[model samples]
Target: MSAHSQHNLPPSLTGKGATLALDGHDLVRMTEEHGSPLFVFSERRLRGNARALRDAAKGGHARARIFFASKACSNLHVIKALREEGLNIEVNSGGELWKALSAGFAPGEIVFNGVAKSVPEIELALGHGIQSINVDSAFELSRIAQVAAGMGKRARVTLRLVPGIGGGATAGIQTGSEKSKFGMGQAELKEALATAKANAAHLDVAGMHLHIGSQVLDLPDFLESVRFTAEQAKAIGGELGKPLQHLNLGGGYPINYVHHNPGANAGREFDYTPYTATQSAAAMLGEVAGAAAKALGPDAEIFFEPGRAVVADCALLLSRIENVKRRGALQWLFLDAGYNLLIDAAAVRWYYHMVNASRIDAAPDTEFRMVGPLCDSADCYFDVEGEYLWADLQATLTGVAGVTPEILAALKAKVVRLPETRSLPAATGPGDTIALLDTGAYTLEEMFQYCGRQRAKAVMIGTDDRIVTLRDRDRPEDLLDAAERQGIVRTVAAE
Candidate 1:
């Protein structure tokens, strides 16, 4: 009945009876040395993920290339590690581009992507002569052309098209649909092509780009997106009187968060098994190679800008329980880590599989409502919106004609996101180290200082068994340094 026996753990984690280790490093010991609420990454796992995606790309298309999305985990160490693995970078802003350069990526190995690019951002990209600037709209294309003309340099550009294909587990993550504000529509694409033709003096139309969305679970949608993009590229190339150089299918490859779940209340949406990089590549590139060949030339390259799948499962967050409270029929366990550390949990009802690192081998047969240290009511791990809808539906349907328990149960299944309660070791309580798995991607990038709490530290376990600090924990005095620097407040010496 141990959680390890019931759950599908990531390859980086191994649970023994009283201990949980990440890539052979003890979690409890790590927390004891670095303090609770720490982020740990495995270099071996990271390399494995990068190599797997690279191999999958090569297997699908001989000319395929991967550009690691720096917005996912911009830790310089993480970026440098990926760079060492021969993965290029895709940056969303001027800052990420600078970081990519600092991480040792060549200017030609970087691509810039963003909807609203400021003048300075455009200038910085053109100054460096990066690979391609993904043009989000016709206006952006004009702005880039103007900037390039002023600088007397030709800019490499790609038109981002919205294929109207919606993918991703949540609505917030969908980007390729026509309604999303991410890419150019048919009319805008035409305008962009005309503008590019006119500005041939300052612009070189290198390729076409389309990103379906992040955490995409649908395979057929990818094929449809590729076909649509290929059709657009062919037309655009014909109008430009030359074959396009590449097609960048934005990355939204999904990662499996829930390995095993027995609770009936746990929604099926949370337990989805995602396709591997190998399978996804074959489906997207191999299945649509013929269409790509017919549109672009056989030597044309395929580019991928993956952010989450490459890093999501390479790390875990370790937190310690601070307090335990028992109410009438419910028990609540409070953790030191909260929305400040993992904002997606509260912001989007994101789920990260939790296990008791201090009681790894014990039977996880006890249910408890897990809450964070934040003062906000929505700071808990449960899905707040889903719970509210479920409760409201029950109250509204009561005493209505033809309202049956079976109907209510069926409705409840769709409304609930995460299980109302989490099962952990019966003795799990205060002082126990809890490990949250698959937190490598967006947690650090999205984390912030809330409730006057300092941000957590991050460490990496190298393949050589060396533990290196990626980031230092924020200190108490460090919190006030910002205010003092801005001249808003000053700290006085203690009497």
Candidate 2:
């Protein structure tokens, strides 16, 4: 009779008695053997998400190609799985490019994108002959030209533009507005293209890249950006003395994390709906193509970079309950997986639907305040950035009535909200594994060790039901400093 028993659970999870299995593999056994606080990814779901995005983008434009955002989840195995589904790789840095190459992503199938690319990173990207490098700023474009010319290779690139559109549930994730640190404005875009044309011997301007934002729910935002891109692309080839070859629209299609579908929060047990993208990828892509088909024509191919939408729902974080206690009219549950492992919990207050995997079918009738393992008070599992709570935390902490922008950001980044009361089962306790749903994106790569905890294992349910380790759980030695790995270990004798 509980909504938590059904809607919040992912498609790959099915209940059998008290056990919840993922694709016929027991989750409890998985946590036991592989260790607690593990990342369990569904290969089936990864492929399905990729195919769905590809289908969506190609619906209107058959030449549409998808580039999986590597910053979402850079696990080599996961990257390869997504690539097999017809998605190419788009990396944000040199490390990601290295991993993409190791995963066997062809040079032409990869794209390098970042604001502050180092000389060595540019050299590496050019040397590898990746598909295209998105130039974030004019300075970066000049730097790329130098690197490419020195390497005796033509650096293929696209101009990333700020189109005055915003996205994401929070301001932090919104990337396309004028306030954003990424991409060039219209004037800058024209200048950058002219610069690339003048230096055609080193840098080649492929097309323009526009991303209104990440976690976008509305289709109109995308359509506006697409039209703007086509308009820009119309002017690009003329300036560069050649036709535009591709248009890269960076991906920000949101995934509904809390409710089964976006905007279904009314009857839901929890009040969390990250954002909504009402149209399917194919539907949205169709509309964009329809809007831009005239200006872009057939020659300029379309490219989509989908990071969160492709991988965010393919995996979930599995952690065991470590302890339970009462704290001032609230029940506090300590989780082995906390903000350290799930950075979004504390970073931008990104919510992930939680279900007790050990009792996945049990009725949820209790509320608990989830706490992480860190010593910092700011390390709790929830953040309160609402209007009233901001006032309350500010007034209570510093006794200030009105606040400044600097103080507001600081408090928002580090404030104790209501701690997100979850209606988990009454029997949820220590050793029971808690499944955080739709965590396949940005969780693993952003994870860190704050409370001296080593990073967790990323285990995949391979084809034919085989359990393969995509990434190893960090051993104590892995997290140790030079002194500890040598001198400290030698000093501490085992009895």
**Looking at model 2, how many pairs of residues clash?**
3
**Segments in model 1 whose C-alpha atoms lie over 4 Å from true places:** 1-3, 261-297, 399-407, 481-495
Give one digit per residue, the lDDT tens place, for model 2 in 17-94.
Answer: 686788878888888888889999888888888887788777767788889889988988898888788889999899
Using all chains and alpha carbons, the TM-scores for the candidates as numbered come to 0.93, 0.89
Please give the lDDT score for candidate 1: 0.83
Q: Which candidate comes out best when scored by TM-score? A: 1
Clashing pairs in 2: 56-281, 56-282, 217-276
- Clash number by candidate, in order: 0, 3
RMSD of each: 2.8, 4.6
lDDT of 2 at 396: 71
